[model samples]
Every structure is written in structure tokens, then in C-alpha cells.
Target: MTDPASWPQESASLAEYGEDCVKQWNNVSLRYRMPLRGFFSKRVKDAAEVEDLTQEVFLHLIRRARGGPIEHVEQYVFQVAANTLRDWGRRRRARNQDAHESFDAEMHQPVTDISPERVLLGKEEIKRVNAVLRGLPERTRDVFVLRALEKKKYAEIAVMMGISVRAIEKHMAKALAQLGSVVDKAGEQD
Candidate 1:
């Protein structure tokens, strides 16, 4: 004899509930897993990833079912599978974009020495410029070399030389004008 409220009520334990959901998912998912695998295989090359994605679909169904029994299991499962694939696509796009960014950085610093002849010509030009620079007045040569070879800004050169930016600019102009004539003479020699 038991009170009406205390009478044995039918309710599955958590483990039993989970097992029931898994069994149902297994039975229903078998029919669709092949189709889902085929669908995933078209986009993903690795069979293992396809299989893993398929299992993720079932896992999603199991988690969702834990909330309550789904009324339309097939439709729900397919929808979840589609969402999983979309998520994978988004991740792959982000990964590829990151890879392309690294590739672009490398591309910006290309190995410009594509030919030995170009290398030799560049070296010769540098030698001629060095000879011309040596012939310049000490102050002009220092200013020009700092600005050109060392790639210092005019303001920086001014600070280092204890001169004004305007003075550095004038020195650069005079250096270029003199180098122009020197380059012309060198060209004639060549």
C-alpha cells in the first residue's frame, strides 16, 4: 500500500535515457549516415574527417535529444549535419586566409637575384657609386651616405650632423647634382 504520489512512476534513469536516445539515433542515423558521408566526401578529401563529421552529427542529435525527445528526428539530424558542414567550411576559409597572409608576406620579400648577370650589373653600379661617393666632400659624402645607404630620414641626419633639416636637404640636392655628372662621366667611360 502506497500513497498515490508515492506509487511507482514510470521514468527512465539518466543512463537508460541516454542509451535509449543513442539506440534510436543509431537506428535512424544508419540510413542517413551513408548519404551524409557521400555529401561530406565531395568537399573533404580525408575519409577520416568525413567519418568524424558524420559522428559529430549523431553527437549533436544525442545532445539535443537530452533536452527532450525530438518530434522529427530525421529532419533535425539533417539540419544539424548541414550546420556542422557550414561550420567546417568557415573554419577552413579562416585557416586558408591565414596561410595566404603568410604567403603574401614571403612574396613581398622575393629573392630578387633571379639571374647572375643582373647580380653582376648591380654590383658594378654599386662600385661606381662608391667611387663617386669617395670623391665627394667629406660632409656631403657623409650626408648622402647616411640618407641613401643608411636610409636615415633627413631630420635624423640633421640631428646626427648637428645641422638643420633644411641644411641636410640642401646637401642631398648638391650630392645628387654632383653624382649626376659623375654618373654621366662613368657612363661615357663604359
Candidate 2:
């Protein structure tokens, strides 16, 4: 692991959000690129495109890593990579006219088709949800979105959120309990 900076100022300086960072990550990408491509190609059965997708994954990581702080650098990088794969699945399904929507899309999108009446109801529910999320001691919103929105696995979320799988389960429990009641109540009425 790299040395942790003493302060945000010092850390901020280390922000290599520059050409060098992209180059560095690209090198790393090449190292793992083939194996990763091979692995995904088997399932997706698109060997030719896998290489390009692998490069895209690293490119995205480079962009995001440049934008801001990453609590666990390695973990965050891989999580981003995994999500890229999930996004591919979503696109492919949409292309094939598959009925099953990817969890990835559902989780990323905010509740849509909200009617005025529903919004009024959801207003309080949204507040309650915000409150519930805010009540969470840590980054509950992020964790919840990654798992629920992105449909990312616990291990992926844990790495991205920098929490343990056990902790991720616990956080989701509280998050769902609070938010679920609100959603369930809304769904029950008419």
C-alpha cells in the first residue's frame, strides 16, 4: 500500500490527475488485461470485444480516480472495473430485447413515473429515507446505491465502500428496514 498522507492538503497534492496517472493505470491494465478479458469472454462469448472493453475499464478508472479521494485505492479500482462489466451486460440485454432489466440500470435510476399524488406521498417518504440514510453512521447512501442501484455484489461494495462484507450486510439491513417500510406502505395503497 502507498503511504497515507498526513493531511488532506498533502494528499491533495498527490493527486496525479494528470497524464502520468493514466499512463500508470494503463500499464497496470495491460498486466491484468488479458486474463480478465479471457474470463469475461467465456461467459459473454465475445472474445474479440473483450480486449477493448478491458481497456475501457481501465480508462474509466483513470478518470474517476483522478476526480477525487479513494479511501481504498486498489479496492475502488477493481469495483469500478466490475461495474463496467455489469454495464456491458445491461447494454447487451437491451440490444437483444431481453425482458430482464439489469439490476445495474434499476439501481442507478431514481424512482421514475412518480405522479403528483405519489410525489406528495413520496415527499415524506423521501424525507424519511434521507433521514434514515443520514442516520446511518457511515456512507450509507453510497453503499446502498452501489448494492441496490448498481447491483454490485457485497465484495465489490465492500471494496468500493471500504467496509467488510459483514458490515455491508448490516448496513443494508438497517437501510432497507427503514426505507422498505416507507416503500411498502406506498405500494400497498391502491
Candidate 3:
């Protein structure tokens, strides 16, 4: 499989375009699954929502591939993922607004899951990581989420975040530093 951090390469021949494109996308999907998983994992603390968003990411890639000659397919995919996330966030915000208007906060029902302890703990860890994400500067978090977690190329991240590729790299470096500090503190707690 191709490294997830690498961009999609051009097709060797036009006639074999479909095959090459599918192969490239599949390779990327397999490799970048971790990064995509991580990004959505943070964006939506819920496992179910993350799973659904990841599926949407791949599906969007497939649709975008249908037209041919995406000079930088990796960048395109990241852009799509970011845009989709924005839409999801808007919908969630709207729903929350509606809920607030409809019912008293204290009267809200709590969601409960009676799953095994391990599953619950894993979910809790995801929530913690997500909370850490919230503490990051917006651009830093996006860069970190896309580059470290989604394994996206710097060019792709820059395009999605609408900044220079170098900015993306620098943001990633800072984000990693922050993450390391947090991890160290958490370890000390343990």
C-alpha cells in the first residue's frame, strides 16, 4: 500500500485511468484510515458518528474520482473531508439549538450504554483526546487532525485549511509538540 502521507500519483496511461484511480484511492483509503479515523474520532466523540463520517470521506473520494485528472487527489479528498465536517457541525449546532429551545436543560434525558467496561473505557479515552483537541487553536487542530491523524499530505492540508503548505507543516510540528506535552502529563497522572 502507498504511504498515506503521499499524494495520489498521476495515471501512467489515459485508457487505464479508471483502474489506476481506483487502485490509488483504495491504497490511500487503507493507509489513511487511521488518520481519517483519528480526525473524525476527535470531531465526533461518539464512535458511531466517527464510523459514519469515515464512510462519508471514502464515499466522497470515490465520487470525486469519477471525473478523471484530479492533479492532486489527496488534497481533494482532504478538502472534501473538511467541508463535510463543516456541514456536519452546522447540523449538530442547529439540532442543539432546537433542543435548547424545546426543553429545559435539566429535563434532558441522559444517553446510557450498558456495554462492557473495555468498550466504555475506550470511548472515554476518545472523549479525553477530543477534549484535548478542543484546547488547540483552530488551525493547529485542523493541521494536526489532518496530517498526524488523517495522514494527509501537507499540500492537501494547506489546500483544505487555505494556508501555505509550509504553514501546514509548521502547524503540525506545534500540534505534535502540544500533544506530546499532554501525553506526558497524562502518563504522570497514571
Task: Give the candidate number with the greatest lDDT.
Answer: 1
What local distance difference test score does each model get?
A: 0.75, 0.66, 0.72
The TM-score of predicted model 3 comes to 0.41
Which sections of candidate 3 miss by over 4 Å?
A: 1-22, 97-190
- Taking all chains together, each candidate's TM-score versus the true structure is 0.42, 0.36, 0.41
lDDT of 3 at 128: 70
Worst 10 residues of 2 by lDDT: 1-10
Write the residue-wise lDDT of candidate 1 on 59-173 in tens digits.
7877877797675455565688889999988987888843654347766887876798777867887887778788888999999999998999999999999999999999899
lDDT of 3 at 28: 63
Task: Sort the predicted structures by TM-score, highest score first.
Answer: 1, 3, 2
Task: Rank the candidate models, highest lDDT first.
Answer: 1, 3, 2
| Candidate 2 residue pairs in backbone clash | 107-149
- Please give the distance, in angstroms, between residue 180's alpha carbon in candidate 3 and its true position after superposition: 56
Off by over 4 Å in 2: 1-23, 69-73, 97-190
| Candidate 1: segments with Cα more than 4 A from true spot | 1-119, 177-190
- TM-score: which is higher, 2 or 3? 3
